[model samples]
Target: MQINQLTRAYRYDGIDLPIPPHLAGDPQALRAYHATLYPAILNAEAIDVGVAGTVHVTEYRRAVGTKG
Candidate 1:
């Protein structure tokens, strides 16, 4: 997928593309994944995951935007 296309898709559907599995459990892994995946997703990136707790979308949205 091209970057522009991905951005348009995101704008319409609010879906961020995922990071690959090999990069899922590490901080640098997400950065590495971003290096590869961002071009395909127009610079969309994943934030660091919480290691000590579960993520709640409701709480997240109240704190941040819907893009997570």
Candidate 2:
């Protein structure tokens, strides 16, 4: 899946993937989009770990953010 940073949207095989407007520039949105496309991109050359499913944005912020 390829994401157009400017639009904060994704596309697979030239087909555009629908993502919410609020999620623009947010990593969590990226993760959710990734999960939905996993089955198709499983054989892709490179996919990062920890991006396996449609996890909520808040959870991601808590898990990855620094309290300081």
Candidate 3:
């Protein structure tokens, strides 16, 4: 349940959960991989949460004319 921050090419804001080695390189595969792992991670209480019982969420946005 340890979420690791990933390196980005430019300044942007987002949540970076480390993709397990088994899910490397493929975005579609990663989604499936997470589908399997997330339940376990949540069961283990590895997910962050908000004060009112919501899962902690993050947002990513591009600056005025900057690519994100």
Candidate 4:
């Protein structure tokens, strides 16, 4: 008899980039991923994470239109 285990991680971004478990759990790595998803957050004055793990930009300004 043989046993095998497989685990997969996908970045929160819709692009489906594979993420290793270690990087996913790292706070700094998580922030980089977040910046990739919402570039505006790079300049955001404040950020809030909800109980459900949702990220909210509490304060930000846009030169023109906004994205993300």
For this target, which candidate reaches the highest lDDT against the unseen true structure?
4
Model 3, range 20-65, lDDT digits (tens) per residue? 6655656456544444634332222222232332333322232345
Give the TM-score (vs. native) of candidate 1. Answer: 0.30
Instruction: Choose 2 or 4, whichever is better by TM-score.
Output: 2
Worst 10 residues of 4 by lDDT: 49-58
Q: What TM-score would every model get versus the actual structure?
A: 0.30, 0.34, 0.29, 0.32
- Shift of residue 38 alpha carbon in model 3, Å: 2.6
Backbone collision tally, model 3: 0
Which lDDT tens digits does candidate 2 get at residues 1-68? 97532323354454445566666567555556655655544333322222324432121111334557
Model 2, C-alpha of 56: deviation from truth (Å) = 25
Clashing pairs in 1: none
Question: Relative to the true structure, how large is the alpha-carbon lDDT of every model?
Answer: 0.35, 0.43, 0.38, 0.44
lDDT winner, 1 or 2: 2
Return the top candidate by TM-score.
Answer: 2
Model 1: CA > 4 A from native: 1-15, 39-68
Candidate 2 total steric clashes: 0
Candidate 4's C-alpha lDDT? 0.44
Instruction: Give me the displacement of residue 10 in model 4, in angstroms.
Output: 14
